[model samples]
Target: MENQQNDVKYEEEYIKNSRGVELFTCRWVPLNTEPKALIFLCHGYGMECSITMKGCAGRLVKAGYEVHGIDCEGHGKSSGLLGLISNFDN
Candidate 1:
């Protein structure tokens, strides 16, 4: 995990119509001072990526790994409401 004090910065956003609904997303790009090795990320539940996740992204950026993530539609900030919606559907 990348630690604080690293000037690494990342982008945050959402992915739309991914399978079903929009996906709240985030991106962490390495400094690009050197070639990146890999990428790491996690999908959200039903909301836009928040500061908490941003910190995580920053860390990944500092680690020299491209980071990408998505907030699961109808879960994160994509669209829809809470589990109640799913319950009703079921």
Candidate 2:
């Protein structure tokens, strides 16, 4: 398994969703070439993707795939309250 940090590019950013909540997102991409595929990851409840998924993302990136992850609203570095909310019930 490839795990060289230099073989991949990592990035993090925050984006505001339609509800105006800021969400944390991160991505890992292979350097110098197009990725073989794209993979999106969603962390489980009470989990965040950045630190928890770093190793997994790195390996995928070095293997020629692009990986992306996001912190759901209220989880990780995102804004809002913890636990689930029924936003669609309004």
Candidate 3:
């Protein structure tokens, strides 16, 4: 994990959805250079983006790609009832 952190740039933020709900987001990119591609990662149910996706995102960043992740509405640092989604289509 320590090796992955070295020379890789990481960032976190919150985005508001149409319903005014805050969603947690994160990204990883190669340090001192632009990424050749962008990838969006999605974690499984009951998993947080930072925890489960970090290693993979780090590797991708090292491989000349930028990786972005988002915690679902009810998971991680997002605001909502745990393990709950109001609608699948939303």
Cα-based lDDT for every prediction = 0.57, 0.85, 0.85
Off by over 4 Å in 1: 1-9, 18-20, 43-48, 84-90
1-90 in candidate 3: lDDT tens per residue?
A: 223367787888899999898999998878878889899999888778987898898888888999999999899888888989778886
lDDT of 1 by residue, 9-83 (tens): 456565558346655666666564563765656644444454547777666667677667666556555565563
Question: What clash pairs does model 3 have?
Answer: none
User: Ranking under lDDT, best-scoring first?
Assistant: 3, 2, 1
Look at candidate 2 and tell me the lDDT of residue 23. Answer: 94
CA deviation > 4 Å runs, candidate 3:
1-4
TM-score of 3: 0.89
Measured against the true structure, the TM-scores of the candidates, in listed sequence, are: 0.59, 0.86, 0.89
Candidate 2 minimal-lDDT segment of 10 residues: 1-10
TM-score, prediction 1: 0.59
User: What would the per-residue lDDT of candidate 2 be over residues 1-90, giving only the tens digit for each residue?
Assistant: 133368687888999999899999988988888999999999998889899998888888878899999999878888889856657464
